[model samples]
Target: MKNMTLERITEVCGGVYYGSEADKKKEIAGAVIDSRQVESGYLFIAVKGEKVDGHQFIPQVFEKGALAVLSEQELSEPAGPYIRVESTLGAMKKLAAYYRRSLDIKVVGITGSVGKTSTKEMIASVLSQKYNVLKTEGNFNNEIGLPLTIFKIREQHEVAVLEMGISEFGEMHRLAEMAYPDICVITNIGLCHLENLLTRDGILKAKTESFEHLTPEGTAVLNGDDDKLCEKKMVNGKPAVFYGIGKEAKLAKTEQGEKYLAEKEVYATDVEPVGLDGTKAVIHIGAESFAVTIPIAGEHNVYNALAAVCVAGKLGLSVDEMKRGIESVKTIGGRSNLIHKGGMTIIDDCYNANPVSMKASIDVLAAAPGRKIAVLGDMGELGENEQELHAMVGEHFEGKGIDALFAAGALSENLAQAVGKCSKETEVHYFKTKDELMEELLPYVKSGDTVLVKASHFMGFPEVVGQLTK
Candidate 1:
């Protein structure tokens, strides 16, 4: 809320301030776009969303004791201070950018085709050891959400871990403009947003834009195993810090076997063990190490831990602090959340999915001790290669030792068929509707089976996750 006075906000956003001249210097306690969350002295930004227009609730927010309002449409002689902008969302971003500048906190911005959220959680956990930290909540990594996350920063926070997600060109630039992060972490460049970015090279271009507003002295931490990210020349003329299981990485894994790595600096190859009930890992970073166990699954989580360790080390957090913070990290709602119910274990990863993540989830399912049943739905926004990608996912299921596969959505039919052709041992079923699929699955799933449900957000596969847990 620092430097969020009406006069300063108006100056930053270049809006026509239409209110009492005496209230120009009045301060706002907070900013919100949702009327339900509005509080006294809060500035309500009237954003015209797809489902609901925020302007419709302006009067309600004013009644709730809002100090000011930002509107796209003009009001007929407003009662109190208000700012009229051509676009309320744009103005909100501008105001947020200005507010972000007022804080002396270090902002660590993370982005990638996959694992951004998990990596954000890991980084925030490690940094929270020594500092008061605020991180991106839920899927609030988009333009609107990023601004709102910035608005959540309080005076007590010493560092802000902001996750930046983009599906098209120019989105990251806009997000970075508001964040201006002190440290930028690119989890990896993978086949996501191909609808907008077109190719992996395109993905790299879009994901790396986080460096656009980075401070000159800021660091760009990248996945050394990713061919695209590893080839980057420089970020703001500073060499990129790479971490991965490969030899070229500054923080590479050295331990033997599938799970444990023994090398020095934040290696995922170290023995980071997770029980069937939850996640557990011990990470080594530059003359320091800590054992952290979380309530999440998948080997990919180790990389998330590595990214966090690198960021925390850069911020000067001690080894013990990192250990405690990582151990305290909990499972996020939709991302890789493990729900146990009725003698079955459900890996509810229905938040979102890509080819990379789909395969990773399969790996976790393959590791489970009981009969593994994968309920997969359509993965959206993959451009012209959608069919091939869906088939590739199906092939992964075919090769894995999964007991059964239930696929929903138009694209997933191809997946089911692909699995059927490749593997006779696995039973593949496809459904056009979620109701149809659930009807069939509910009767087949045994008490001892382990179910993994995953798809993009649009597929609404969380319904399957909910049913399994219930």
Candidate 2:
């Protein structure tokens, strides 16, 4: 809330300030766009969303003790203080960007095809060991969401881990402009947003846009295991920190090799998976090595942990701090979070799915020690070969030792059929809708089965998980 006041907001956003000239200097306690969230001393911005025009709630917010309002249209002799701007959302973003620059904190901006949220959580968890941290909450990682997330950063916060998500080229540039990150982290470039970014290389180019906005001395933490990302030696002229898992024999061959060389790097060896309990791994940083148990399952999470360690090391965290941080890191819900209910284990990873993430979740399901039942839904924005992609996912299920496959939505029908053609051992069922799937889901799921529910967010796969868990 520092430098956030009626006067400061007007100056930052270039708005026409009206009424209570004396109140201009009064600091607004908070900023919001929704009238229902209005609190005492809050500044409410009237954004005209697709379904709702927030201007209708301007009077309501003022009545609820809001200090001022940002109006997209000029009010006719307004009774309360207001700032009239062409667009409220635009002004809100500008104000947030200005406010971000005013703060003396290191912002670690996270982006990639997968694991943006989980990696943000991991990095924030690790950085919290030595600093007062504020991370992006919920789905607040887009243009509007990113600014709203930035508004939550107060004076006490020493580090801000902001996750930046984009579906196209310009989106990341816009997000990066507001975030102005000190350390930009790319988890990996995968086949996501192929509707716009047509290829994995295109995804990489769009994601790395965050690096262009990094501080002059900023660092890039990359996943060295990703083929697309591993080759990059520098970003925006600054050398990046590369981390990955490699054979122990290769660790000693650091003889001026370009692939092995990095500005700073960390890798893992002796990675031992302990099923649902989590993973035990020995992380190596130069000569220093330590064994740590990451409190999460999946080999992919090992990379997530190493990425956190790389960032932590860059920020001056000691080995013990990194160990504690990695151990303290928790799995985020809908991003491979494991849940046990009614004698069944549900891998509630139905948040978002790409070809890469879908396969990763199946790999997690493959590791479970029970009859594996996968409930898959449609993956969105996959471009021209959407059906082919769904079939590819089914091909993954084929002979993978899956006991049952329940697919819902239009695209997933292809998945069920693909599995059917490939194997008779796996039972495949298809549903036209989530409701239809729910009707027959319970009977197919046995008590001892491991259910993996996953799909893109639009498919409403969580409703299916809800039915199974209920």
Candidate 3:
């Protein structure tokens, strides 16, 4: 919004301007693809999707007081002014990249195989204690979503905690170019997005593409416990900041080319999981330490907290500030958010899942008091080894003292069989569809029972959580 005048937009996007000269120098209030989000003076970008074409809403957006529209197709005698580009999405990315260069904001670009959203929230919470922070909202971390998130940054925001997600190789590179992060954080290179990436190493290489766009003075914050990440000593001529739990001692010995020296280590100790309450830990950075409690209900959240500590430390925040930020952080829905309704406690982690996250959620459910039930579904984009991955998650539930397992989706049938073979006493139920599972879910769950609903986004397990919570 700084220098985003109509003339500047046309120049940056290389689009042909088709409107009055009076509006050429006018700066837009905001930009959006959705016509419903269009406000007075906002720029509407017309994108053609599979189900709907945004061009159809151009007339409606102008009536709603939109200042200008970015279109890929020609309009006949349209309202207001418009710019015609070869591709609206490509134009939007160019606009976002230009806008990012105009801002004096410190961006924390977060990406990994998993835990991207949770880590973004943690970093934002910690940074907000000292700076006016703008973080990515919801699952808007893709190419389109990342640009939209960048467009939301304003003059008042001091820092932008952007979550960069990808399923392919060059996607992160494009996102990172627009973000131009001052600090890059890779959560962990787990078994995710294997459909396109094929393997963990492939996933690591793809996720680290964000580093290519890191500013010269940028720092890389990595998870030391992760074998793939711990080996990274330096990035962009700057030593990486490594954080983890139970891996601090090894950090110093981790080989860095010819030298065996640790980068900057921020590790946690005395990690105590408080059942559904969350996790308590002592975070150490250099000679200082802070005793903190994360009220988000999972041991995996400790990694998220550690990532936050590493970032906050780099940003010159005090231990007390980090502790308060870590403690005050609240869970977003579908990422281990705790919900109480209909006489039952539901862990609605149904937003998305990989084998690692699925097992992590199971650990949370296993630790809860009373009857522990796991309602799981298929994990998408796992490539050819998807069955083995699903079965691996099922094996994690074995001997965890889980009361019952309700698995939906075809891939989860492998999960059901694996859990049954390993944990003979655990009641395993397989449903062909989530609707069928939902019908039986309510009857199986009793008062005071703790239920964990989890699956990949495509599984639509939120509806199952909805039924139970209702």
Which candidate has the top score in TM-score? Answer: 3
TM-score of 1: 0.93
Estimate every model's Cα lDDT from 0 to 1.
Answer: 0.83, 0.86, 0.91
Number of the predicted model whose lDDT against the real structure is largest: 3
Estimated TM-score for each candidate:
0.93, 0.94, 0.96
- Clashes, model 3: 1
Worst 10 residues of 2 by lDDT: 247-256
Best-first order by lDDT? 3, 2, 1
lDDT of 3 by residue, 143-207 (tens): 89999989999999999999999999899889999999999999888988898999888998998
RMSD to the true structure for each prediction, in A, is: 3.8, 3.4, 2.6
Clashing residue pairs, candidate 2?
none
Runs with alpha carbons beyond 4 Å of true place in candidate 1: 246-265, 272-282, 290-295
The residue ranges of model 2 lying beyond 4 angstroms of the native Cα positions read 247-264
lDDT at position 139, candidate 2:
80
